[model samples]
Target: MNRTELRFALHLIGFLDSVEGFEDGMVKLRDRRWLVWHPDVMAALFRHDRDLRHPPSRTLSPLLGNRSVLWLDGEEHAKYRRTLAPMLRGTRYQALIDEMVERSIAELPSGPVGLAEWTRRLTLRITGRILFGVDDEELLAAFTRWLDRRLGSRVRTLAHRYLTPGTTRFDPELDRMLLHRAETAEPPALAAFLPPEDLRDQVVSLLFAGHETTASATAWTVYWIDRTPGLAQDLLGDADLLEATIRESLRLSPPATLAGNRMSADGMVITPSIYLAHRRAATYDHPHTFDPTRSPPPPGAFFPFGGGVRHCLGKDLALTEIRTIVTALLRHRRIHLNTQRSCTPQLRGAAMAPPPSLAMVATCRR
Candidate 1:
């Protein structure tokens, strides 16, 4: 395995071996130190530890900015998250469901396509319209091109340098496009609260987080549903089953496999392994199986979205989007896996993405 995969495997092995107790270890990988923790320790750290803070990764800080909510801590983080919370509530997102469904239906391919790429494009479009109030195809295309390079790049340092806020400027035209949208837009609920200087970074961060995670989750949802015979038909008639399917897919393949690493002001590091936590046998019966009919896992027990104060602000909106996309796709088309190989999750940057080669055929439902 390559260095990144090796690090992930070590952490996973530690988690699997310590399913009954807390697991903590320090590892030096690529010249940086990481303190990884399983759920037992994570529960305490997430709840009572006020000092644990998300230290910006060398790669992410330049892209997300110092002021973005993901990098903020304590009062600043809470304040920023609170401002953005209203836009993600169920009532607000419910109003957008029809539009989301319509868009997915229009964009879905009628023949074999890479499911991951298709979902990423659809989610990016939905995020662009909802968050920025800009539906210009060319602008969205540019943003997708820029974002894909950053996310998919293998040259870590170069990608970090390219995205770092002041080291090198973003494309002038794209900057103007985003700034113009921010100046003229409404909704996304948090836009009004962002200062002019911080607006671009915050918007970029939101767009990245908003589309990337949902794309991974939605892609996995499609894979699992297609793998299970009769699953689509059952979901078509049952709302609970559909919701359960989404949850099960998330449980097995959370997009954000690892929560952001948090470090105390002193010297301690704490990172929560969301992937390991989801697989805890105590919390999930047949932890690895994708069984949608099983009872829902309990709160805190299932956290595809990290927990406590830093919980994802877009959690509700993400769920709504995933449900809408999956429902619309299944309802409008008969999907079948086109590849002979079984699909599995692989790390793509910070998210757990389905195999890049995963292909599926979608036939329109008559």
Candidate 2:
């Protein structure tokens, strides 16, 4: 549990514009510096893992988000990012997660359901089927446990599984599958587009990034829509607004608040201007309210995906997942707030994995 005062301090960052201030309503927090003091900064902190020296340490472990790509950095990060870049950035790979999402949505028969878990299951299923091509009951369970943190993924326990013969060779098996898929698939296929090892890393990257952020963002969008009336009507009326809602929700309640950090190792007298970007009234109208209908956020107004060279590599996948889920949601149901459940969310893992109760009662349409 995060400190209540700390959480309040973090939430205040996103509301900086609410404070009367400079033209943009942004406040200067320090010398020659303006800050927005955004709420989502807390989410960013959850995303960035700066210490690479220790591969599997108490503080920084490669989020094996069902085998994530977060562990690699520097040259490894660049290489992995490049190989998989086109798969999502272009039209061909856009539908990769879409197909999986459609199948997952098919499971939601016309009735009331747990919107948070439904969203999580869709995201997890997409990661499983489309991204990593992983299919292991125990590994999936372990992955969920690892994510939920009711149980931890211990080095010794993970090692024991690998050591035991006939146990799932989760990573290696996927590597071989990627290689074979590349060998057999057409020349322009995604598998063929990436080198063998890079293909493996890319899959892991997609699995981690593809699901987690989208899941959180989707939760926020749902929660926000449920809580805000006019905003919900606007979103439901225009399917197109769904994307805007995602972006605004991200601005209001960022997916990973701390990812914008620039460390000294980044080799510069670095300065961060995230707070200014978020809180500046010039950048957004009524910047503090969770209203999506306000003048759309400014160009490069938010960096939920971070900025500069190490900006989020899986941004496309995450956006695609959010758009797909939100669009489907607008078409099929009306989401109402579950006032009875607690609205508080925890920063799970290295991102804002909202606790599975955002109080979205899904009412089926026709």
Task: For each candidate, give its TM-score against the true structure.
Answer: 0.85, 0.65
lDDT of 1 by residue, 219-283 (tens): 99989988888899888968888888998999888888777777777756666667767777766
In candidate 1, which residue pairs get closer than 3 Å at backbone N, Cα or C atoms, i.e. clash?
none
Model 1 ranges off by over 4 Å: 1-37, 153-169, 186-191, 295-300
Model 2: residues with Cα > 4 Å off, grouped in runs: 1-76, 93-99, 109-113, 133-139, 150-203, 230-233, 236-240, 265-285, 296-301, 340-342
Error of 1 at 294 (Å): 3.5
Best by lDDT: 1
**Model 2: how far residue 33 lies from native, Å:** 16
- Top-TM-score structure, candidate number: 1
Model 2 per-residue lDDT tens digits across residues 1-366: 234323323443333324435553334444432333343432343244343211221122333322234545567656756766665552454566667666665666555566666776678766555443444445445555544542122333334323452333244544554445435544434465565545554554455566667787887787777766677667665756776677778877676644432333433222234444565565677766776566655345677776655567667777777877777766677666555534554454335545554445566777
All candidates: CA RMSD (Å): 4.0, 8.2
